[model samples]
Structures are given as C-alpha cells and as structure tokens.
Target: MSSSAAPILLLALAGFLIGGAYSTWKTLRWLSISLGACAVLAAAGAILWLR
Candidate 1:
C-alpha cells in the first residue's frame, strides 16, 4: 500500500461512520453518539496523518 492510502481509507471510514451515526440516531442514541465520536477521531487521525 502507498503512504496516502491509509489516510484515504481513514477518511472513507469516517464517512461511513458518520452515515451510520445519522441512520441510528433515532433508534439508538448511545450507539449513534459513539459512532459520531469515532468518526471524529477517524477524521482527526486522517488529518494528522497527512501532516
């Protein structure tokens, strides 16, 4: 794998996690929040990885 691939995958994972959070918000508040937090961390990791 290339150096850039990891960050790119991280971003994609963040996107999926955000979507999962949104979809689960109505029925699973706690899970949604957890997924949102994870998404944020993934996004932050991606940004830091690029640096």
Candidate 2:
C-alpha cells in the first residue's frame, strides 16, 4: 500500500465504524459505544499517520 493510501483507508474504516455505531445505538448501546470508540481511534490514527 502507498503511504497516502493508509490514511485514506483508515478514514474510510472510521466512516464505516461510525455508521455501525449509529445503526446499533437503539438496540445495542454497548456495542454502539464500542464502535464509536473504535471510530474515534481510527480517525485519530488517520490524523496521526498523515502528520
């Protein structure tokens, strides 16, 4: 993978995780929170990777 591609992939993964969290919020609060945390981590990773 290219260096630029890594951050892009991480951001995409973050978007997917955010969507999963939102969808699971009604019936699975714990899972949603977990997903949200993961999404935040992924986003942070992407930002850090870009720097």
Best by TM-score: 2
Superposed by TM-score, candidate 2 places the C-alpha of residue 28 at a distance from the truth, in angstroms, of 0.3
Residue 36 shift from truth in candidate 1, angstroms: 0.2
Best by lDDT: 2
Q: Tell me how candidate 1 scores on lDDT.
A: 0.99
Task: Extract clashing residue pairs from model 1.
Answer: none
**Clash tally for model 2:** 0
Off by over 4 Å in 2: none
lDDT of candidate 1 over 1-51, digit per residue (tens) = 799899999999999999999999999999999999999999999999999
The Cα local distance difference test for each model comes to 0.99, 1.00
Lowest summed-lDDT stretch of 10 residues in model 2?
A: 2-11
Cα-based RMSD of candidate 2: 0.3
**TM-score attained by model 1:** 0.96
Model 1 scores worst on lDDT over the 10 consecutive residues at 1-10
Tens digit of per-residue lDDT, candidate 2, span 3-45: 9999999999999999999999999999999999999999999
